[model samples]
Target chain A: MSRLFVAMGLVLLVGASLSIGVADLWAADIDAGLVMAVSRVPRTVAAVLAGAGLALAGVVVQLSVQNRLVEPSLTGTPEAAMLGLLGITLFAPGSALLVKMGVAAAAALVGTTGFFVLATRVPQRDPILLPLVGLIYGGILGAATLWLAWATDLVQYLGTWTSGEFSGVLRGRYEVLWLIAGLAGLLWLVADRITLLSLGESHARSLGLDYRATRLLGLVIVSLVVAAVVVTVGTLPFVGLVVPNIVSRLRGDNLRTNLPFIAGLGGALILAADVLGRVVRYPYEIPAGTVFSVFGAAAFLWLLNAPRRPAHG
Target chain B: MTFETCNLSITRDGVPVLEGIDLSLPPGGITAIIGPNGAGKSTLLHAMAGLLSPHAGAVRLNGRDLSGIQPGERARSLALLTQDQGVTARLTVADLIAFGRWPHHQGRPGHEDRAAVADAIETFDLGPLAARTLDALSGGQRQRAFVAMAYAQTTPWILLDEPLSALDPRYAHDIMRRLHDLSRTGPDARSVVIVVHDLGVTARFADRVIGLKDGKLFGAGETGDLMTSDWLTRLYDTPMEVAEVGGRKIPFAA
Candidate 1:
């Protein structure tokens, strides 16, 4: 059934993508079409990769912590990456893109590690409080980024970086996102270990799984994906949180089997949203992140209200 | 394979929970650990299962120090069902049981893994509920499903922490009987160690009984010898009587 949904989604994506480039739609007008198509290709590819990476990261985080509400955004990773980007634009104004990505990746990694430390210190019995604490931590980091960007007279630049738009994702600037696909593959290789860890530390250890190591590895992977996506495009909210849950509802929570579908569906969802943004106002495009936020907020609310099954170990 | 503890001491939150506990469990029979509320029965089970690192002393599995063995290897030797089996997602009965094979097959299950899962389903009479999600089942059925997961682990030792807490009498009896039957048959016969509150069921079904009181071992011997009224009365600090009913020993408060 989910496969059917995905198939329909694919068709919708192709139609939307083609229609968005319809001004140069004819194949015979090769030069004009190539110029338009070539320009859109990198942004489209970056948006899809970001969507897929964020969604996969969200799945890993949710499963590892055994919590539904957590994602790379909620965990303060994107906030930290934003701060890193802000620092680069402020202090090292002439740094190369690779240097900027490095700073952002380091900041994201630190944020993820901080989350792990907080999780260990907080009582495991009360899990709902964990994400709340994480959100507040993220908010603080986001405030710091805002202050820095404003002080440096780069507030508008920071605004564009934080709203999660694919407009800045041009041909040369978007190649960094391919690294996320590699991270997704690595995540797949350890999918079984992550699933076992989801059974909780004690159960996983009893089964001969190195609970702490696997957990840290998962966090590192999440951080890498978040850093890559945030550096390429801004923070796309709830893709990680919503896509995994929707996929799990249709397919069981077996990470190995569901990962590819999660990636495909994630790419499709973000691409469709990006295309929708293009067509919604025609010449002037609404941000894909804004469209995702509206839809994602509704989906998130539905998930919260839906009758849920009791947890098992 | 044998399981034994040597002068084990455990502390939680700066307070000593279990003190100097020592016991040796032989293979292939059901052993019941019975005690009052704060007798540290759960602590003892956790220590034996390697869930908790004892403050002092050690646990030995089949003559090797449990601390020396790798966690994965330890998992293959023993399966522990903790007190609260809280799962956050909706998983089917077969999915839950397949978790048992995690130690053996990790996430990629093989043909033998599926066969073991099937055998576990058949053993626990969960054939009808194979496709049913765990949240959809009753408390008793859920308890049975958890036990089936442990059974699917196919280990030499199975440690259960108060599995009967939320179960009704019939389901409780059914689970105990199933464990009893499984211990006798199967390729690697399991040594079942259960923390039980009901004295009647423990007295009736258990081959051996270990009594604990106030973080200390009160008695360890055959059920027939240790389940007398005087022993139980002293153990719980309440007047009780033990009587034989329908070829099974039962305990009641006087």
Candidate 2:
């Protein structure tokens, strides 16, 4: 099923790349459109990479927390990154993209660390409470970003950064997303330890696995991926939450086996969503994040309502 | 190899649960820890398995202090099946059993790990259910699958805490019988320690019995020596009698 989606995504991406050049729809020349599409290959690739990265980050967060509701956005990492981007734009106007990305990454790391500390401090009476705490944390950070954006009269800039669009993800602007691939590779290498830790702390310790170290490593990977994706393409909602749950349904919960499949499906899902956003509005384009929000929310509801299987490990 | 606890005490949240627990078990047979509710049987088992830390004294494996050893090394030496073990995701029977070899191979599983997994599947009669997901199995089957995972760990010492809780009589007997057979026939042999409520089954299947009353050791000896009416009465604080039926000891009371 994911393979079918990938093929469809590729076709849509190619079509959108061609449509970017043909100013007049009726008088479109096939050869000119092909040339334009070929030239924009790099940008399209960047978008795909960013989508895949964010999706993979989502997978890692969901698995680590053992809750489908968790994503980097839900945990306040993206909101924190947005605040950092806002800070850089306001204080150090005309800063390099690298500087902006660094600030965002640092903010994301601190936000993630804060989330973990809060989560650990709360007694484990109900698993559902962790994600609720995360949602509240993310909301607070988002409100802070909103206040900063309004104060600086850069609310438009913040809107573009948070809207989940691909129009600005061209050439040099999108290169930062490649870092997510590196994070994905790191996750694969530590997949075994991560899966063991998911069985709960006591069980992991009983197996002689270093639970705390493994959990910290997973959090770091999640932070890096979340920051990179946010800085590249803004905040894409529900892609991470939806893709991992779908992958786990088709594949088993073994992280080693599911990581690649999750990455592929995540990339494919995001690309397809991006393409649909372009066509749904015809000459104008809706942001992929908006499209994903509508679909991702429905998928989330389905997962929540689905009959829970006894083997929920 | 034997496990010994010397003056062991455990406190949770500054409340003492087990105090001055001194006990030893010789290698190679089934040992049952029989106790009334709240006698700290489960706490003792958890401490022995290194899942809980003792506030004072120590638990030793083959005379080496258990706390001094690393968790991985201890895991290789002992396998524990805690009461109410849970798996919160959809995992196949085979996948669940493969977790047993996590300590042996870490992340990279080899042929030996695969063989051990297969051996566990066959040993627990899970061959037919190997491909089935745990959500699809009956409670009895799921219980057996978990036991198989512990079996695949292949440690010399196996500790179970209330393994038969909520299990029907037939499934309970079946599990006990399997444990009994494994203790007797395994190549390296194994010492099985179980916390059980059914005194009749304990008297019939256990080679040795340790009885606890109100967080203290009431008796510890061979099953025959420990199954007297007076011992049973005092231990449970109820009128109790022991009778032989079909050449098997049965414990009963009003």
TM for every model, in the order presented, reads 0.93, 0.88
Candidate 2 versus truth, CA RMSD in Å, comes to 3.6
What lDDT tens digits, residue by residue, belong to model 2 across residues B59-173?
Answer: 9999999999988898889988878665555568898889888888887789999999999999889999998877678888988998898888888998888888778888889
Q: For candidate 2, lDDT tens digit of each residue in A1-313?
A: 7656656766666567545532453464645444444435555666577667877777677656666567787889899889888888888978887788888888888888788778767655565677789889999999999998998798988887787877666566777788888888888898878777666666667677887788878878877777777777888888778887787777667778777777776776677677777778777888878888898999988987884556321
Docking class of 1: acceptable
lDDT of 1 by residue, B1-254 (tens): 88899998999998999989899989988999999999999889989998888899889998888889888788889999878766665567898899899888867799999999999999999999998876678888999998999999989999998888888899999999999987777566789999999998898889999999999999999999999999999999999999887877889888
Candidate 2: TM-score? 0.88
TM of chain B, each: 0.97, 0.97
Which 10-residue span in candidate 2 chain A carries the lowest summed lDDT?
A: A17-26
Worst 10-residue lDDT window, candidate 2 chain B: B82-91
User: What TM-score applies to chain A of candidate 2?
Assistant: 0.87
CAPRI verdict (incorrect, acceptable, medium, high) for model 2: acceptable
Clashes of each: 7, 6
Alpha-carbon DockQ of candidate 1: 0.43
